[model samples]
Target: MLESLYIENFAIINQIQIDFHSGMTVLTGETGAGKSIIIDAIGQLLGQRTQPNFVKENRDYAYIEGVFTSNEKINTLLDEMHIPSDTQLIVSKKITKDGKSSIKINYRSTTQMLLKTVMSNLVDIHSQFETHQLFKQSYHLQVLDDYCGKKLSILKEKYFNNFNQYKKLEKEYKQLKNEELSDEQYDFYLSQKNEIDELHLDDFDEEEFIKERNELNNFEKNAKHISQYKNIMDSSKGMMSLFKDGLNELASIDSSKIQDLHDQLYDAYYSIEGINDDIYDYLQLSNFSEERYNEVQDTYFKLNKLKRKYGASIENILDFRAELDKKIQYFENRESVISTLESKLKTNQENAFKIALDISKLRQENALILENEVKEILKDLYLPQVDFKFQFEKTNLTENGMDSVCIVVSTNVGQVAKPLQKIASGGELSRIMLAIKTACQHNENNTIIFDEADTGVSGKVAESIGKIMKEISKNQQVICITHLAQVACFANHHLQISKQLKSNDTNVKITILSDEDSIIELAKMISGKEITEQSIAHAKQLKKNNV
Candidate 1:
């Protein structure tokens, strides 16, 4: 339920706060009292789209905030917002002159659409303009469904699930069974995969192999210029013998000083010996030949060929091979897949039919009850012979289910109840709309805001509509914007919208009336601009009688 609303700088509303409760809180005022402006503000706070022109002249910004209390479902939504419910949810909207609107729920930044969805469950603003989806031609089916309640809803859910499941298998079956793959593309992929698989290459460190191959190439080029250092040193008795001779000569000069000189020379000789052994070993291992070079070159060329046909690297080529294998296997079992999917699709269709049949049956039952209830409501409104019925059309299986339902009505006695869309009179439309609301108000949770639903109605009919709105208030909040004093007279919580010329501007305002204020206002509505004593007395008598 909506607890309260605070509006500021919102089109002549400068600032107004209204505390709301669980019954019908009616707004009654003279023409152009800015009642619609109040409704519009509430709409904004509830996440309804707003027009820029709604901002008051010279005002930089407009703000509206709504406070709501929720149930279990609303609590779950609060969890998504990451905010504690704390028994109250506040939604606020600020529209600036720059055409920017900032939306917030419980002070958390939010989008208008999100806040609107949340608020929808909490408050339903039924406007004065007979703009209800139920009244509109396009919304006939939805109204029937709502009246059917959970009976139809559950069946519809089951039907839709089956329908969707069938669609899934049907789509896959179509893709696999109906597609014609190109022969060239298939052969290309198959050859690529087979070629990569045939490589039989060792999973050695490729980086290391390349390094070794480069080293081999270098050794092959420099082999002739290299010499066996140890063989030369031994055969010619070159540096080794000379170094030994120098060490002995140093030893003879001074025993201690010569010993140090010999030790240094000995160390140099040992280092030279190690270097010679390494050079000899490397030369021995070089086995480089033109034939081996050809082998390496051919392997590089083969790998490159695979890369162009498949991918840039060995790892990527391997992945592509895996994909091709899966696709080919799918084609191999294409018949089996189609067979399985066809069975599933058939089974799903059967399930959907059963569910949709169940839903249709329940709607048929509920439709009878709803029609009777509407007839009763209409009887009270002085149309005892009104013909009303719920009409159903069967459509192809849809997510919303197989039943296409609508509300049908005929104002005159013995007339066939055609679809509500075909009825043209405003009075009949208004009455039938109220009749439907009266029938299903028990299931709806949001506040019922009716703006001039009583238009083109008067006398006992007007009085009955007021009584019906008042009755609706017992279960849900009812806000009726009305031109008729009779309807306004029945409001338990009456608010009035009136306008005045101020500072060369027309300003509108709303006021929630006390009983005394209501009577005077009702009299003004009853008697027009000139309120005579007799009309005021009549207004007084009407209130007295209702009380």
Candidate 2:
């Protein structure tokens, strides 16, 4: 049960703290007196998103905290999250002006995900807008599962685990099938692979061949240049012969003066003679045959073609060849693998279907019990001839199972039951929700907040709704925001919210009323801005008679 709520610097109501009790508690106020703001603050504590406007006009942050009596389920969660808690669990939310927020439980920092897990077991706030959830068919599964309790949940987890495995394998099988090559395509790939394998080009040095080809292509020009060079350095008519003859003449005149000059010329003659001999050898051994050139040219052209088609380098070509080998192997042995996958898929589908059938059986059994209980509750809520049916239809297997559950109802007797969304009026929807709430009983020890759940209900029906809430509070705690005198009069604790302008700022104040004060408040609710002596008397008797 929720023990207290303390809100500071929140919208229009600065620093308001409200204490709660174990039974039915009602908050009554005039329109625009910040009653909904209090609910919104509780919502923020429950892990709902808060807007920036929730902060007061001049405040930089909004803080909301609540104290709750921890139950076994909640304490177990806190232990799993390593959060320390005593008998009482204090949860707080702090939101800054920049929209950053933090949550703390028992003075230990916690995350929003953890807070939601812990608080969900403590509070179940049902606002007016949540009634639309009744119209959605998908929500029915959750409702049924909640009714079925732990037995259905264990089976549901097992079914989904198997279903996921089945889907994964099915996807893999389809991918492999799409990747399988046809006969003609396989043959084409085989031919390409054989062509590359037969080449034996891995050991051939293309760089050395390219250098040799260049030298041979310029052989004639090179031979001509070497012959001219030999002529210029020859012994008979070359520059070296002239230098030798001049050296001999200079030596015959002044041997000492010409000795250094003759020595230098001798060295020059020997150097030129050695280079001429090497040139003659090269000319004698040069090979420039057309057949060899043609062979080299053909091989170079073929290698370039392979480079463009396969890859720019030998390593790349080798890698592509390896990939082709894998593809070929797959094509050769695909039939056996496909057969295995198909057999596995069949087994998986059977298992999933079997589990779905089991789940459906359970739901069908629970549906009967649910139908009877809903009809019984609605009868007391002023729907005497309401025909309530739990309709089930088979659908393809989803994460939720293979059955679709819908609530069908008829407001009058002898009328065929149709979909609730199609036939139920607004008032009927409200009562139907209340009846489900009463039947499911999912609110054990939970602080259930009903924001005007008594709308579209009046008189005896309103009184019945109030009585139901009061009874529910015996096991759980209920906080109701209502305008109905019938509902508010049954409050174990009645708090009035009134707005006042203090220091030029709107102030929302909550006052816990006395017995006499509650009668006056009820009278105002009954007469609406014109409370009379008779209205007060009626309010007094209304409270008395209900007691």
Candidate 3:
């Protein structure tokens, strides 16, 4: 359960701290008293999307934090995430005017998605808008699936996988069948295939070919430089000839110092000669020729043209060539491949159908139970004559399954049941939605918030709605924002929200009303600003009866 909430600079609420208790707690005040603002603040704590306008008029940012008593499931999740688990959990959110937001769980910075994951089952808030979703037939299937929970989810996973495989094989089969080529098309593909096969692309290296082509393009300039270098090093009047003549003259000296100098010159002369020999061998191996250069240029042009027509790279070209081979092969042996795909598609369809039938069976069984429970709850909410049922239709395999569900209802006796969107009035819809909510309540300890869920209800119907909420609170926490005095009398705790002007700025304030104060507030709700003796007595009697 939520222990307390602290909000700062959120909407018109400059700053406020409100404590929540387990049981039915109702927030009541005059219109525009900021009751919905408080709900929005709690939504932020639950990781709902925030808007820039959420920040106060001149405030830089909006902040909201909630302290909750940890449950076993939450603690287990925290352990998995390597976060320390304690009895109390602190969740906070901050939104700035610049459209930036941050969330933290126990002061540890986390992402909005993680916050939502942690808080998803901990609190369930149903606003008036969510009640309208019942009109959508799609939502009806979702509701039934949610009621089935993990049993249906696992079956759905298997069906979805099988269905996807079937679709893939079906698409491949269609494409292959459509690829029947005429004689002219077959000839064109065969020629293209032969041309690519002659290239031996498996051993082709485009990078190495380009490198060799660049070297050949600069051959004339390099050849001229090589000729000049050979003349300077190996010509008769060049460095090598001059050094040899000097070494020969030095060898004739007989003095000891001259012998030492001659030995050093001998070593240096041979080192230079070895380097010259290596250069001569390299020049001989080059063998640059005009024929070879022209051959490389022709290959380069052919490769570029292939790239333009088939692909932009060697890998893509090879892929295109492989596809051409398949097309040619299929034209010659089309029946065999088509037969194989049909067999696989039939097997896949059977497997998917089996799982979908199992899912539908489970849904049919659970639908009966859910329908009975909804009718029972509706009877308590003063719709005793209501008839409700699930209408299921077989559909093509979709991600969800092959079942299409619609909820139909008839609120009056002797009336034929029709689709909910067609037959149900606003007040009747509210009661039906409440019945569904009660029937579909999960076993988890969730804090359920009703933001004017009793909007189109009043009189004894409103009182019954209050009673149902109070009964629900016996297991889970229930917070309601209501304007009806009949509902307010049943709250275990009553909070009065009122707007006050401070420093020429509107601010929202909340007060935990005492027993006497609650009675006065109920009287105001009953009489609408002119609380009379009769209204006060009526409020007292209503409170006494509920107690």
Candidate 4:
């Protein structure tokens, strides 16, 4: 449920913070007192698109924030998103004049799409426009499924998975049956297979081959450098020979210091001699032949050619080769492969059909319960004569399980049942929407906001609508905006929205009404700008009767 909301520089609302509570709350004011503006701000928090004009006239940006108490479902969702779970969730949105916007959940930056997904589980906002959704045939099926709840959801998921598998097998079978390789095509595929098989690519290392080829190309230059270094170190007059002569001369000295110098020089001379021996070993092993180089070049060219014809890399080429083997096998054993796929497709289709039938059976059973519930709720909404039924048609297997359900209704006695969109008046539609909402209420702690959904009806019907909302509030939170005193009188909490002029700018102000103030507001709603004694008495009576 929405615990509170803060709006700043949003349209005419410069700055305002409104705290909300559980149960049915009503917002009432004259037209254009920013009632719709408040709803729009809430919409922004729900991830609706924002416009530049939503910002205050001279302000650079607009901001809206909503705080909601967390439920198990909300916490589970937060866990999935890797956000820290808390007792309260703070959702905020900021929109700049350049049409840029940013959204945050618990002060962590998030995308608008993700915000919409999370907020959908937390709040449901229905406006007058949403009431018209009943007229859409697609929406009828969803409503029926929602009413059916978890049993039908589980069945639908099963059918969806099975149907997708069936379709995949069916598609594969058709493709295999349609592909008839000609004699020339078969020969071509065989030739390609033989070419790939001859390469013996399983043990090939292209990178190592390239490295060896580069070494061969520069072998002469490397050999010349090695030869020069060996001559400088191993010649009779070279550093190794001179060092040995110096060591001999030092050894001939009779002094103790001379003997230590001779020992040091002797160790250094042997180290240089070891390096010379290593260079000679390398010269013996570093033989390069023109024939080996030519052979490598030919192999490289062939590999490049195969890459250009089949794939961009060796791994991709190998994958393509595997696919070629499949095609070749299919050509050779066409009848056997087709027979196997046909059998698998048949089995899959039968299984999918069984699940779809189970789904359709459950839907038919639940439809009757939903119809009865809608009828009972309509009676309370003052549409007692209205007849409600579900019209079901068998459809080809689909993700929703081969059921096409439409809502048929008769608004008056003796009237033939017709599609709801054709026969229902605007007032009847509103009442029917309310009935559906009440009948389909689930056991989730989500806030429901009705933005003047009570329009186009008044008197007892309006009062009944308010009573229904109040009953819904027993399970979850409900907030409504209305002009009728009949509906506003039932609110457990009342907020009065009015425009105030400050510094030559019009801003929205919300006042949480006390019991007496609520009555005064109701009286004003009933008597149009003047609260007469009779209207005050009527407001007081209305509140008393609802209690």
The TM-score that candidate 3 achieves is: 0.71
Backbone clashes under 3 angstroms, per model:
10, 0, 0, 0
Model 4, stretches more than 4 Å misplaced?
183-326
Q: What C-alpha RMSD separates each model from the true structure? A: 10.7, 14.9, 7.9, 6.1
In candidate 2, stretches whose alpha carbon ends up further than 4 angstroms from where it belongs are: 181-333
**lDDT (CA) for every model shown?**
0.76, 0.85, 0.88, 0.89
Per-residue alpha-carbon lDDT of candidate 3 for residues 55-98, written as tens digits (9 for 90 to 100) = 99999999999998889889888777766778888999999999
lDDT of 1 by residue, 242-270 (tens): 77787777767767776877888789888
Among these predicted structures, which one has the highest TM-score? Answer: 4
Candidate scoring better on lDDT of 1 and 2: 2
- What pairs collide in candidate 3? none
Model 4 worst lDDT window (10 residues): 281-290
What TM-score does candidate 2 reach? 0.71
**What does candidate 2's lDDT look like per residue over 157-264, in tens digits?**
999998898888798678768895999989988987886776666676768888988887688678878778777866497877887788788778666657887788
